[model samples]
Target chain A: MQVVALSCGNGGKEAQDFIHKVFMPHLQGFLTAEGEDAGVFEARGALALSTDSFVVDPPIFKGGDIGKLCVCGSANDVAMQGAHPEYLSVGFILEEGLEVALLQEILASMQAQLRLGGLKLLSLDTKVVPKGCVDQIFINTTALGPVLYPHLSAKNLKEGQVIIVSGAIGTHGAVLFSQRAEIQLDTPLVSDCQQLYPLLEPVFQSGCKLHALRDATRGGLASVLHEWAQSSGVGIEVEEDCIPILEGVRGVCEILGLEPFMLANEGVCVLCVEAKDARQVCALLQEGGAKKACVIGEVVAGRGVTLKTPWGSKRPLDILEGELLPRIC
Target chain B: MQVVALSCGNGGKEAQDFIHKVFMPHLQGFLTAEGEDAGVFEARGALALSTDSFVVDPPIFKGGDIGKLCVCGSANDVAMQGAHPEYLSVGFILEEGLEVALLQEILASMQAQLRLGGLKLLSLDTKVVPKGCVDQIFINTTALGPVLYPHLSAKNLKEGQVIIVSGAIGTHGAVLFSQRAEIQLDTPLVSDCQQLYPLLEPVFQSGCKLHALRDATRGGLASVLHEWAQSSGVGIEVEEDCIPILEGVRGVCEILGLEPFMLANEGVCVLCVEAKDARQVCALLQEGGAKKACVIGEVVAGRGVTLKTPWGSKRPLDILEGELLPRIC
Candidate 1:
């Protein structure tokens, strides 16, 4: 038989690369999602679970890949259901002739990041395809865990509330583009990709009325914000200056003719809160490890999301089409 | 771009066959796994899950593939942990210029069988590839479902319990050859590919002190049996004749230079039993959906599985070596 170049799937080098380059740096705290022989996950009380598969290509980028993206992606889904991320079972589908060393690197990175994010991976399964038959690799991460707020739901996004962001936007997208093109930035750019459990804990424990919490993934903040606005049947308003943006990232965006507002940010989140305590809630979030936290926007009387520009002019923000950086992960 | 020629991945058919006739029959359930609008999967419970892939052509023959073998090949995997097969998600990776109708027929046939087994199908995802990249269409099915017995745990298997199986031996392998070429047989060959759960409920409810239950897939019964023997640190003995085998399947196995004992069975199981309650427990399983159920084996004083033959000879059943039917599903 012809030994066409191919890579073995499951816990190999390419998968491992996916972990370190995109997933590890963005997360923090204890418990590992990447390193152990197996992940230790549990839910003593009632649990909520979700699993997702990422076939997004160029497997690794500055922000994330099918690997880490698969992790946070599943975790976030559970969190939306008011459940904390606990255990995750990862399954891999790799094309043959893949880089083994790259796979090991990704695993090491996943192990480290999961540990930092304080997640325990419960189980793992893998499969390999012949080269040319698959798009490098695909990841299916299934999660299991107990619900934090028993009756809490994403449906809790009340009409009268404020919206907040934990950190800056577009850093992940910018870093990924710069890295992929091998286009060096004047100042090195790194993705802002991260896990949210650590920061959310304080909010959850503080008993603050967390009306809504969501991480801007595809379609960025614009799409999710629009979705919330439509679902809540209320309008949202945000000041351009209030949103955080790193200088280095802004330079890359300008050079590439990209808009930060439309770019993806894996580790960033948007939280809606009650009107009365919005400021106080924002302060608590910033103090509780949300280094770049700020009141990015607010819930208004009308429907849809609007942006207040530097000149005080307003325009509706829209979800840009296609990927900002195809497979920016 | 130049188009490439492709043979029907499913048991080669003439190029002039009707499109729907080739692929439609392969569609399995209500939500077809083939020819659909990007598989629509509904979530009844959070745990709806499914899995399917092709082990056809060179992947079969040596061991298993397509048709008769695919049933237990993937479905039993879901059953191992006791998850009820609810919805199956199917996908096809076809070589370029492939016959669309050919692929459709395979899906239709699968859907019919799944419907027969009461398996719901959620959606289908499909992709096209240029020829030489892949041999033929590789169908991958993913199933979804709510856990039937959330409390069904392997922990129920005790040290002193017995094990049992529903029906006859390897019919899957026999059918593959019977369909491939003309062969001498006492009668028509058949494959015993059926869901194990239909016959499992009564056993679970009856209090047969079952120590563990494992559905044999990849390596066959001996492999899984050996897993129990070593993991549970128990011994097992089975009388050859007590294990059922259809006459036609046995005849085909004898002529094709194959071993029915070692080949895979889509609908069968080998059980371990305690010395005291073997017959009573077997009777319970037989009365349940498993009318042909039999006590094929027992846990012995020593470790490992021993096969007792009519000639008073005993031998060890082992796992397969290397690749048994390269892509046998």
Candidate 2:
């Protein structure tokens, strides 16, 4: 958010000047999108559709917004399902009389993230209501992605796809949880809130064998693994020691008496791919700076997940251990 | 609604049993649909997707519930765009401690309405919070329809298309308004809340040549007409006398001192097609019991809607009309 000329407040030449000089540089490549009631773009690949509403209070968090998160969050879902994200439709439910510049800033953040992830927004809609009615601005983003690879959906989870964790988890949950806390683990940990498409392009380019994918957000990988198990009716076996827990993320969880299994991780996913292609997929993941990529588990023909401890002890995994970091404001 | 060994408790298997017995009969075509986590179906054509939230007050109204309306509202939006409605996704945001029986009834209503509309609900997600959190269940429905015909979005209107009203307007608004009145109209008005797909299927199949389609829902024909004109960059002209308004509907609106133009109408539309095709469309619509189908006006190559009065005077159509309908209740 850089301050330029203040002359853009006027309706005619100044407004157009502001649009061309400051905004157009950022808003280009959106065909005929510069001057229109709504932005429209044709989709290019297999249409993967997902809608998410970002009504999180506090306009800005430690690492992101309800706006930028709104875009990246929905995009990751599309990518997790193995679709090349293309078009996004944004609906803004704005509290009345929000500063126009603030709205533009959020839109700018959203567009910047979309560009970073190599996706184009297809359409946008804005609705205004009285200020008391809502908590600032809430956005509902619905995206359409083309499926360049059809076998990426969770439905294709085979009897055996090696499960890989992208990186250390619980960053998002821990950051959100320790907002006003005295327990400082270092430079207070923040969400790993970022896009995953940059992380995915290389793997797709490498033609690595893959079966299914999912992002562990609202419910962590534990919940996700459980869903995958139930959907595929395949059991999962994992060594508990293989999972990486960052020091800060782990410390906060320990202090709060919260299980990391149920904490959200916005920037990572659990990919179920063929064991044979696990090395190549890890190499591709390295390009995205994910050094913690590890094949943590294997799929078997059973019902649920079971954890194998270092002492050769086993315990059943409760897949629905969801959102242990409850109501973090 | 049946006397089949019933109690109003929404707990246990009673709710699921009621849903299966009463609602499953309405949706017989699903192959893997016997109490599945989500409805799984093949995408057969071009898809038109829509989502709407049903927060209508009274919970139960003259024709439906938040459950019934949620399905119908989303399904109707797809129908308005001339799409063959197929799949629906239902997500409920329920307040905890709410009667389980009430939930069961709502879910039953939802399933029944989906069956009645010949739609398979592809997904259902239920989230709960402690009591007093949620007032009533707020249902968000997302419906998908395959566009077998060309997309008849509001953005496609041309200058010569005739504006056709599908039926007597304001019936839904009147029914809702009269629910609180001491004095009612001689003819008690029930909401015209029925599936628009039954009416749309023939039009999509008959090839009657439609260019633009819109539902006279919340904001009515005036709001939709205004939207169409703005989207297509064309002007709409409507004759006051040609428009159909039911006697009881108008009476209730007059007594309530409300502007019927901006009120909600659940089962109505403003269809724009070539003037030559108007008769054919009207004939088909009439056959479907939409007798009030009238050619209210035509389009001109300017933007905005102008309403012509019986005395030959014209006024600009503005959606900013002020009226408090307490619609959410």
Candidate 3:
């Protein structure tokens, strides 16, 4: 089987041949500037630029791979700023002796995600390190897009703003944790890794005033809430039973003693809108295929996040404090 | 000494503490968007976007480290496109056991470079992998700049154009190779790693109608010439004696059986200008501190690069065919 060699990343004939023969075919139409040191494009407005590096172990996960996660993660970050992602700059660090077929599969996955999000690949770079210098692969993607709605800051959250979650949380984190720990479940669990722009586009178009928007990524839903509470100096009160968690994911969380709220979610986004527009925004997200979209909490005139248990007890929801999982993306 | 722990990158309270206590102090004023997922900025006119991942082994070398190289390399790529780098999005992938003090030093280096280049840190992401998953650290920098001079491309090279090198070649590659191979040299060698924008700014202001501009990185002088020749379908003939090589670097190259032309340079740039403007461009670069700036070759009506020896023999210079030195950048 063909595998990547150190020479492929040497920036010589071998590197050129590798790019042309292996990468270009999969990303032919999306790449705007293939050979230039940098890609030049026209930009004339307020732009949101976000970057993320994906180092998920077992690069190929249940429902997605590192390639898709890299693209989706950055795109979602940009989209959370109420922007329409338009371009991407990606850098790939590969380990020598990695299977060429696996690399191709990842590239193809990235291409598919780019097409889905209507983002053009503006610039790309690839480097190969010796075996064991890096995990199988690590991808860093920087995304840029024009802002459709301005002033979507966590500081904009006011008391009485409703918090809505686009979908079930913790699936992505649960799937990766299970895969790494070799834990099997009665029901298969897939990551909720996907682009968020398409789902959020209609809300932006509806002219709804979004106080704050954030994808519950690394530190998950609880982290986003805590940040919003701290940044806006407001209290976030959520009903524990109202937050959606998949059955299998809940089982995994129970088995692993992981809090579902603290687990990562690539496709789930937390939104804060005025109470008056809460239902409308949730409806728009649901129409955009976020079937589980619903309002779960509200911004109150206090500090920190509080969870109201179904059994009539309230507890503070602090940010994640320890390492839950490494390289969960 | 405190070292990077897996929890520091978990995007939780510890991650926040790490950023606020460690990273933010070093990068206080330069970071535009500290807490936001992505930074929002106004960009107008044509823009150049470039990305590069620096995995230079040892992380720290004689004259520079991965932090400085990451900043300079991406900024130089944008500058080569006749753009003034204005913003950067950096992603740091750190190993679990990396020394926090070393990371602080690297961040300081990055801040220094950013200040030197007059660039702002727009967005940043940090991820920590488990031990052995990554070599100490790898940094990915994505640079964005406004295009000051448009239409500078490798395809713009034409017959009769003269090639001007900003400085000596092969120092970076030689330094890295010697360090990795543990070769003892009588004379110490340092990498020629610096921001090229400052040196080339005067040339852009001169309005010399530059045909092409490229940093002689990765595969070095020979690779740049080969790319230009193939892209513009012209022949480049260089006088061997005209190409500048530091004495210490030349000795290292001879001992290692490596061609200096194929070695990498971080700070050096190769510019293609009209024959009439070659001397003026060289003067401007020399005035800007590239004291070794000189004309090394000229474009001709043929294909590939030819090296004319001082002994009166001509030989073709091919693109680097194999791995000369990995992670030289």
Candidate 4:
């Protein structure tokens, strides 16, 4: 049994050898010469930076593994700010006895995701804790990219701006719940985990005036709307019927008595764009693979989010109150 | 009993409220607006990037806590590359049920460390995992700084280059062992956990011809020398009698059957400099409060590290093997 020994994470000869032999080869063009304590690089202009820690259970998921989630999560965060994913730093905390082969598999997945965004892995740090100290592996990623769409702040959202969701909501959260829940549901449900840079790049380059863009990771669509509304001091009226919810996700949420709007997402984003360019942005999103992209609602004068149901009833959608789900990311 | 509720880490309204009430006030001028998916910043020129995941057990240690360790560890790596630590992103993985007060204390320690390095916290990601998933808290910090020393590499070492240790060795490892072991030693053995930028800034500003610089961290002094020797493909000869080891640390090592050179040191660093400038750099280091700074070795013509004993005998110093100590970071 080839296990990741405690010595490999002890920052000793074994650790150094493991990194050089196992990690370095797979991270070609991503690693610099091993000399200085830190990797040296060049950066200029406005940079969009984001960091996320992935502690999702069953790191290997239905649609994507933790490695993919780590890369896509941070990259999408940067992309949501209208930046081209460029440089990233990866940190891994592993428990002793983890299989080296499994770690390699995760790294391969990470490499694949990095290739998708054309991002360079600038640095990596790995630590191994005792077997019982941690359940398994946790990954943290910090990314830096040059700003492509500048000054797109939530405060920039004005009354009458159209709201657009790039894809079906809550699929990622649904996948996690289904995988964790003992009761197996027969559904074609998988996480909506993929790089958003390709899909959003065209929309950004299309010169659509994007007022605000945020990934609906935790707290989902509801949280993003509430945050935008509060920050911009503008009321956002979201039509409940307009929100796109995948049937599989709806089924999972129904099983768990959870609302799809409050579930987490990995690659999906919510955009507040000029009302006139909403159709064009939605079209670009759809053409670039976000088939479910659509206009959900518009910003209005007031505070907080208002959800208008299909029957013409209005209700306030506050930020999800409690720990709806832990480690969903 | 007040604790860091799961909801605080759930990425919902409770999490948002916790961040706003607890974190934002302390991180003034560091956090950007709350709506964007990522933080935006400006940067240019040669940037030194480093990331470290601090899993120091008993997170609150004698001299410092894990938060302090996380900040200093990453900052030191950047500083070793001759960079002034500037922008930083912190990621926290909190095990559910941790006390909010304890988390606050750790954050306070982090704040103090950042102040010492004059770094700006660019972004922060917090995740709450179920109990037992992680031990209390783990912090991963990624830092970027402008290079103050253009090129510093272990490969730059040459024959006759002098080695200078910034301070006493093995204090940190000894402290950890003492805290973990049931032995009650009367000696005040505290971790040598402090920022090195202040001490090294003078030496760098004095125009010393520093060829290679590395902090003797996990695998300790022996591993650092072996790494330098192998990386430069040159032999290193160290006078064992001259290597600075604290008396308390030696006592702890003797009791634990561990070698002082194999023990870690948080604030200490080893530097290879031009022979003539060695004395000058040592003097500057001492003036900067590293009073124990002195010449300990020199790069030789062969490979591996050769330690010269007082009895006129020489021996090879290989990289430390096995788990000498875990979670000593």
| Chain A fold similarity by TM-score, each prediction | 0.81, 0.83, 0.98, 0.97
Residue by residue across A64-128, what tens digits does model 3's lDDT show? 99999999999999998888989999999999999999999999999899888888987899999
Off by over 4 Å in 1: A1-46, A63-67, A150-159, A181-187, A323-329, B1-163, B169-195, B245-270, B309-311, B326-329
Best-fitting candidate, scored by DockQ: 3
* Fnat for each predicted structure, in order: 0.02, 0.00, 0.85, 0.89
Which candidate would rank higher by TM-score, 1 or 3?
A: 3
Q: What is the TM-score of chain B alone in each candidate?
A: 0.73, 0.85, 0.98, 0.96
Candidate 2 interface RMSD to the true structure: 9.1
lDDT of model 1 at residue B325?
28
TM-score of each: 0.70, 0.79, 0.99, 0.97
Q: List the residue pairs that clash in candidate 2.
A: A45-A146, A46-A146, A46-A147, B10-B100, B10-B101, B39-B122, B57-B328, B57-B329, B235-B302
Give me the displacement of residue A269 in model 4, in angstroms: 0.5
lDDT for A41 (candidate 3): 93
lDDT of 4 by residue, B134-199 (tens): 989999999888888878887888898999999999999888888864554556888998888888
Tens-place lDDT per residue, model 3, B59-115, is: 998899999999999999999899999999999999999999999999999989999
Write model 2 residue lDDT over A1-329, tens digit each, in one string.
Answer: 23322223211234345456644555566423333222323333345566555544455668876667877877886676566666665555454446667667776888778777767654443333443434456566655566655656545566667988888877877777676344434546777878787788778677788777777776577767776776677888877888877888888888888667667777888888888999888878976799988888889887788888889899986543223432221
- Tell me the tens digit of each residue's lDDT in model 4 across A90-120: 9999999998888888889998888777888
